[model samples]
Target chain A: MKPEYDLLVVGGGPGGALAARTAAEQGLSVCLVEKRPAIGVPVRCAEGVGRDLLTEFMDPDPAWISAEVERAVLVAPDGYRITLEPSMAGCEVGYVLDRKRFDRDLVMQAANAGADIQVKTRAVAPIVKNGAVAGALLEQQGSVSEVLARVVVAADGVESKFARWAGLETAVPLSEIETCVQFLMTGIEIDPGATVFYLGNEVAPEGYVWIFPKGDRTANVGIGISGKKCRSGSRPIDYLNRFIKSSFPEGRVLEWVMGGVPVCRPLERTVADGLIVVGDAARVSDPITGGGIYNAMFTGRLAGKIAAEAIGRGDVSADGLMPYDAGWRSSKLGMALERNYRVKEYFITLSDEKLNRLVHSVSQIDLAQFSVLGIITELVRQDPSLLLELRAIRKLL
Target chain B: MLLIRRDICGYCGCCVSVCPQGALELIDAYLSVGEDCTGCGICARACPLGALEVADEA
Candidate 1:
């Protein structure tokens, strides 16, 4: 007899693992599945997280942190550099994770929490029964089996089909999706405590290039470009190759990663009958930064807790899962996403001249009392009409 | 009317999801462009790596 699970979480990333662990901790029987033989292989992220936010959720494990960033460097098209020293209270990032270890540790936590983990097991499709998701048909090692669950949590990343399979509108417009490529390069002389960003259309064509240092001599050098802005038949790899040739000619590429990020507003509906989508599957990433780990964990934690409660009450319908959606959107994480998306949409269309001007203006701002309002004020000083537009954004946010 | 940069395609299946006509499929890690494609350019536009394009073959 196939063992029935009260909660089944798919993907095994931070969101899925955390959700499974959270539910199991609440005394719910949970099963977590990962298609990969191990988690976090062939890492696709640049892997930087705000220190304060990371610590707020869980204790920072020594094994997971590769480097601690203290400064941020932004270079404009003309090679004008703007250095920022983010205060402890601000949204400055502090850690660049060793992604492999970080992801494995999360899965380990889930396993320790008593969730049945099945690595190398793929969830082929949701088994809908009686008009709601009953379980999923899973395939592993040439064998197929059914794992029934009262609720299914889809924590799959941006490329997930589970949400759509469960009858949700998960389509992302071209303009809102970022095609990304990353190379873990070694032998580069870079500050391990500084995160670098190169911004310009010529640099990434509607996106930016980043170098998040993992250690003194190695970093994750990457580019993320808007899908629609790409020229006909040109790959991000072409741009990345050119950037590498110019910037880090001596850097040795250790690994190559290719993926897409959906940088849009959270889906209007993350919950359907007996199913809830969290993380990138729900487009919970920050549109401006394309960072989803924090939001994923936030939504996952809440979804697991809420799902456990719903199952306890014997109501696992869409209505029962609505509270998870409401709780996540009402938190600070939701507020940041809402505001960032507005800012990103407003600024993404800026021309090269305007972008250079903006970068130049940002360089001139004093960091002694850095704040969003102060930066906006400085930007308005450079381009007076921006004051009015920014005011509109403020109102919307 | 569809141009695929076969060498550049990363086989991410992002295009498969955006194809309105269901003309794209990832078979064994390879992109299989079907005859049902209408040259709507949605797949080309949605491909993150810019691996697809619409050619003026008409």
Candidate 2:
């Protein structure tokens, strides 16, 4: 069967939902499809977001927040710690969200905006006509159907087939992908005010381990290992379980989430003829930190706004949507993402010993007086030799 | 046509970072070559962005 709509958004995650809502608000008839049975089921995120990053798009609804974070603790491999005060940390200083509520809330907003949400509907392929993407073919409840629209927004996550199917070559290499495993645990005494980050190859190997407090007693303890490193045989979960046993031995496990993050740079082109890809699908997450929600939401808003304007003008080609890409590249989200990608590459190349030493060096500095970016830039400034070391190290990449 | 995704490129300086001949350097959050890229495509693949592409050099 063929269903027609003004805008057909594939994948009802944050990006898709927001796109649908924004498009609908612009008076476009919209339909959002998701493969999952519900909006937020089978949570894939680390369940953390910065308060400042979130404020630009929408207000923090009390229903979506799980905890309020006030500080950050940067831990070295040898257990040295540098605490970050909220004011210096910039945005994201105050949130450990309940992603279930967070994801549901975005979709709820879309639904309230008059978009048709289709759960358990998987977008199998892009519908094309005259060599241009027109919409998508969806598999709903074991039956296949076609949905047609003037524009298609591909918001499918890291394993985004739609983006590839739509003709944009968005492939994340193994080295750039961080395989992550998280456990929601209780019985661990953690300060709700602070989120802890542990950096060292011995612990995570090219990535790091994070402890994001959901409540005073419960936390999402997780570890991320580079996929290239994992090819040698150590798994993310194995490392995470080992860390838990050694660090929070008394903590009780409540839930688990295994996922991958694209920590590489962003895609060169996010737009194709008659189609736009957003969020993880477009590699919109932060490379250094692996954070995507803020960037994803920001990109989604731009895509939605651009798509609405294009549809209204009846111009839905690649040329018509170039503004979305240009606008995003100039935004603060884009600037930070690009800078972080460079820093992440520098970080992953550090040897275990260098990492430990760097962490030790950082732990001694007063983080409250400097931004994370400022601290790293200072580290590079303090040791001109380290720049040479980094240059020498680049020979391996 | 060689296409590079800008967002996924990790400026690890590896493409230019690890070039034995000093062919690459980071310029404004991206790795660029100094008229001697060698068309090796090493930087292209070494790039987490998959941003670098060795095309016709045209």
Candidate 3:
């Protein structure tokens, strides 16, 4: 990497890759850094993205597309299954990706776009000049160096550090974080075209377990337990183990992955003087589902575009960078994040009985949309008494 | 005191985001604790792998 660039992006996930690509494409000198030695190893995601959203970034490549999902099932606590059509499956059913290849493809695109991509290079601290983040103190192969830039984009994933070092409180609270674990196992009987979600506190308190099919008999079986609910002997892995034992008794383990996701509202501020934060780093992941790839890409691209515009105008202060923050907050993705956070807060308080009833009610409806609001609307239609609780979220839809 | 069982740690950085003090850092995929850690045990509870533990003051 050169001693400096117009834009410096930290992290190699979809967010950073997109940020680097967008900024570089806009004629800015860009450098993207990933602390991991390679891209997309130790896959942290459940490898699921909506078909519509996936198509927006790149056409599905067979090498990275594990499954072309057509249907989804929601298994209630009492074992009542509700089958959802692909259109009504929300964001969970679309494409179960092989993220190991998918993530690399994105970074390759950024590299092709003229951004200098560095692997295993970390930004140990932010470089501030004149009280603004000008660049980062980067560490590469055990040696540290100063790399200056006009703007620094913190696209780091859930464990975002550069933004914190630059003076933003990005810490996710215990109640707002999901401690997750996933196992890729084969020999399990699963419909390759369908993904499944099992909901119940007993199985995963304040969270859910999922089966994202990778193939006919192989899938990413994962559980996300609320961090606040995780206790000794009942951690996320323990719950996932119980699920594997019951659902895929003879499945052979292929891989194990563990991580955390922020299921909270977007950060109070995602931009600072000469800085912008994107994706999970900005707490832009869906609060209910904890999905973030699309959000990350969306914000990453926006940050790039706005950064270029701000620099063109000869201003890179927080005020000049406010457009990146404002642009996303009003977009469709931002609305969903806000709506999902509220719905998540409400749903987490529901007993399994309420969820079962709601799931049963929605299963019978020909819902126009498959979002949380759609389910809530149908439930309120069946029982008018829920209008009070539904009214708050009703306004958003 | 706070203790980390590196043997079982997957180094996914789950414990870092929830630290109120911002006392934990995940660099090079390695979980590191800073001097500000008060043994609050929040990271221990947030760890999905149960790799962190906190001992009460004597």
Candidate 4:
């Protein structure tokens, strides 16, 4: 007989794991399906996350963090640098994490909360009954089965098909996708506690290069370029290689990873009858930075709470899940994401000259006490003409 | 051999930036490999456009 669950989460990434944990904590029966044979295998991230963001819902364990970050180095195309020091950076702390361990920890937390986790289980399609999602057809280890649930949360990553299957308009235009590639390297000369961001069209075009230190003279160095600008027939690896050879001439790469970052605004809606989507699955990543962990977990918590409430009310419909939207939007994560999206679009459309000019302007700011958003707002304030561009970008936010 | 489809390349230069062997170069807005091309396939994977095609060099 097929197992029944009050909630079935499709994907055991950060978002799904958190959703499962949240729902189970609320006393709802939850089952999580992970397509990967083991959670967090073939790790695909720069693994840089804010300490404070993760702590809001769950405390950080030493096993998951590689290093404590204290500074951020912003470099322009011409090699001009701006340093954001630690004293004024507040608890907006940063950490380079062991992602595999981090993901496993989340799954462990969910399992401890009583959610059933099945590995190597893929959700093939939503099982629709009477015009609503009843459950999903799952393929496990080459065998197929079905599981029924009252509520389903799609926490799949950036390339989520579940949203489209659930009839949500989840397509991200190429212009809004950032092609990223990272190399884990050793023997590099860099500050072990500072994260570096390289900006300029010459180096990364519409995207940027990042050097996130992983500790002990190693770092995850990578670049992400806007897919629309990538139409010029240059791949991200080509750009990364050139940068590494020139910048870190003595660095030796130990591993390589290539992936996509979604820079689009959050989806118009994240809920449907018997369904909720969180994290990258719902385009909940930072539109400007392409970071998803914090937002993913935040949305996951909202989805989990709403799912539990719906199950408790015996009403797992679209309207029942509306609270998830309201709750998440009211949270700091949502506001930051919305503002970041506006900031991202503004920077994405800038030409090389404009980028250099913007960087030059930014270098004059005392970022120690200012958030990136505040800096942008100040820039707009200085040049009132930028208000027009800000207004156009604000619509998407 | 990896063939990069010109239409999809983002020209973000990520491939050029991460290549370990210095095999790729940006010329006329397209990524071209020199004789030292290692066929590492990293370039293809790094291509967000899915523009790079990696096949065994015949």
Superposed by TM-score, candidate 3 places the C-alpha of residue B43 at a distance from the truth, in angstroms, of 0.9
Best-first order by DockQ = 3, 1, 4, 2
Candidate scoring better on lDDT of 1 and 2: 1
Give per-residue CA lDDT, model 1, range B1-58, as digits (tens). 8888988787666676566565665532467777989999987876756678889886
Write the residue-wise lDDT of candidate 2 on B1-58 in tens digits: 2344566454333344223344554432444566654665544544332345667855
lDDT for each candidate structure: 0.82, 0.76, 0.89, 0.79
State the local distance difference test value for candidate 3. 0.89
> In model 3, what are the clashing residue pairs, if there are any?
none
Report how far off residue B1 is in candidate 3 (Å): 2.0
lDDT of each residue in B1-58, candidate 3, tens digit only: 8888998888888888889888898876578889999999988998888999998868
**How would you encode candidate 1's per-residue C-alpha lDDT over A280-368 as one tens digit per residue?**
88989889888888888889989999999999999999999889988898899988888888888877877777778877887577666
The regions of model 2 sitting more than 4 angstroms off are A87-92, A363-369, A389-397, B1-58
> Tens digit of lDDT per residue, candidate 2, span A146-205?
899899999877656687777777656757777777889999989877889998878988
Best by TM-score: 3
* Best prediction by DockQ: 3
The 10-residue segment of model 2 chain A with minimum total lDDT is A388-397
Candidate 3 B-chain TM-score: 0.88
Give Cα distance to truth, residue A388, candidate 1, Å.
Answer: 4.4
